[model samples]
Target: MSAAASSPASPAALTSSSRLAWLDALRGIGALAVVAEHMLPWFVPSLRPYWFSLGVYGIFVFFLVSGYIIPASLERHGDVRAFWISRFFRLYPLYLAIIVLVLALAWWVPVREAVVRDGSAVAAHATMLLDVVGIGGVADTMWTLSYEMVFYLVVTALFLTRGHERSGTWAIVFAVAAVLVGLVASGAVFGGGWPAYVSCAVFVLGLTGVVLGRLRTVSACLLGVMAVACLLLSSRVPWLGAAVLAVMFAGTAIYRWERGTGPLWPVAVTAALVVVAPVWAIESGWWWVRADVWLTTIALAAATFAGGMALRGRRLPRVLVWFGLISYSLYLVHHPLLKYFVQVSGDLRQAALPYQLLMTAVALAVIIGASALTYRFVEKPMQDLGRRVSRRCRGGLQGGGEARVPGEDAGDDRVLGHQERQVPHGVGDHVGQGDTVG
Candidate 1:
């Protein structure tokens, strides 16, 4: 979920924009990896490889990006109410659009059987906590949003309490929890759909109070508790849920380390624990979960992120940055669009290898083209609207000083990890005195 607002106004803001592009680029790369993981097995089976799961690798990169970026966002803004409002607009417009689209397309492209088609599903989607609430997403790719939402809630709470700087500590805690939980809990520990309903209620009420500025502190604390509990009790794979949070905070930990405010050792420890997390779990049956391959995937994602960090000062490939620009749209629409093609074209795997390759290229091109359109018409407009609202709110709160943040003037955001599109800010900006930065 990242986008640049417009061009920067000053030399300082331009430097901020340039450094942040690598993050958006990572998001783009991650989204395409996810698209390939979903696309290849269906239409180009022979080309699909299982050694390193493209989907998981992509998701990890996103998790890290969001972890690194979100703290800066909330911290710099320093207003929970405005932060949540912006997040809502950034994430929901396209998200709800896709949800409805998937549901409407169900007749032609039947909804995945995993979807529960009930009140629970409704509750889960509303909170964007589908996976943690033990509910299937209407859009198959939406599960990751659950973790992103949880991170937001938890980070907000930390910011409210001024404990936001302990990211490295949280990373290790979650990583250790991942291994511990994996041994004993493979599936949801919460028994049924009731957790979804209950948590949904909590989410709605908590947000309502926070937004309304009534018992705001209490509401945020409760929201954080509810989010963490949901993660621990109801995630489809308990350990993976824990591990995902760890990955996110690990991103933050890395950012802190880069800023010279935190230690790098915890990040290393967190990585080691997460890499070995699946090795002994009862639920570790997926081929990609194999110790060696999982380690490779985890290492590769880190390396990719690290590479971006290393090359932050230098100008990157225009194509990579362009990928970042349309990343959110690409992430959300590609899968369902692929399914629509599968419906029309049938399995191209049965055709000649060249035809399969050609059709795959065609499908990819169409997806990219479609994504570009949605980015223009849907995502960018909503992001701009969200920022305008944020500006008004901020002005009202601050009594008229410039409360602008990086990527605010230029459009950019959370990768969707959909952390949503149009980043509020990215890593490497000078620490401005503001809200607990993303």
Candidate 2:
């Protein structure tokens, strides 16, 4: 498709009820891959080697989807303040609930001391920049959030500058940078020192920039610089981190191409870079790790994403769609539940394979059930509240006036049901929205 064909002039130009069922299915599949990646080693030992680190593959797919959708959301709103508000409500409520629940459980369950430490945990929660600030994630999956935050900052910057269409260019730049960094700074980048403090400072500044981005250009530029700096200097795995962002932007570029916002050239270039950067980084920076395994996983992730795009016009299975709806909760809740399960089960490796498999099935059931409740009670309600508040806030700003963006209206209650309709200000959207941090 031509770039102009995909690029709508304004947010109002797109249909609010235009749901991407295939994207949801991809999310459903990705969520299951993540869950299996974490759970299978404990229950199905024989299958461990064959799993090929589905966690990484799943997250890569999630990031690509985030790249594709988040930019559209920002453009759809055209108001950074509203975008940020939507994002805050979408992600934090569930996140806070998970943190509180985990911490409470930790009191009795013997959680990791490093995760619960006063300085690290407090800093992590306060900023949600735990991994960037050199504090380990309180939850193992949270490291991805820091990267997601950085992506948001960059997107916001690009949005404010009206440079959002340059996603392909940015993707290529970052990918090449990753390759260069891998070659030159492979070993030196691993140790954390002053960079952590620098990251903390950048995050604070970036937050301020986003808040002021709509009001001033300089703030937006500052946010952009901070995001780049964090990715380059502060990321725990700087080369791979850069490559990951490149992959995400490549997804964004593809979205722009699909939407007719930009030319196909950048998308084509970005697609090539995305495939090559990870393989090159693995070869250069992570020589000790199995290159074939990592390469195969990346290939699968790319293929899965391509398949979803190809089938975007078709209907997907309801069960998979339902899984996508609750994906964020599942991603957040499952790991900790697995940890608790291991604690309660007490060295299940000694158990017979059949018994272990049965226990795994039960654990999956419990996790899914918990995720369902959390989605209904926590995720859904909070998201609804966010929309109401954001609408009101936008209305108040516009002096109690409601201007309908393209396809939004009183009869369009189904609008927000599509994850992409909601701009994932920082993380992506919920479920198919960018909450796939695991």
Q: 381, model 1: CA deviation in Å? A: 0.4
lDDT (C-alpha, whole model) for all candidates: 0.76, 0.66
Candidate 1: regions farther than 4 A off: 1-14, 280-284, 395-438
Could you tell me the lDDT of residue 153 within candidate 2? Answer: 76
Model 2 ranges with Cα > 4 A deviation = 1-18, 49-51, 113-120, 187-209, 212-215, 275-289, 395-438
Worst 10 residues of 2 by lDDT: 421-430
Candidate 1 colliding pairs, count: 38
Q: lDDT tens digits, residues 340-361, model 2?
A: 8777776655578899889989
Cand. 1 TM to true fold = 0.88
Per-model TM-score, in order, reads 0.88, 0.83
lDDT accuracy of residue 29 in candidate 1: 80
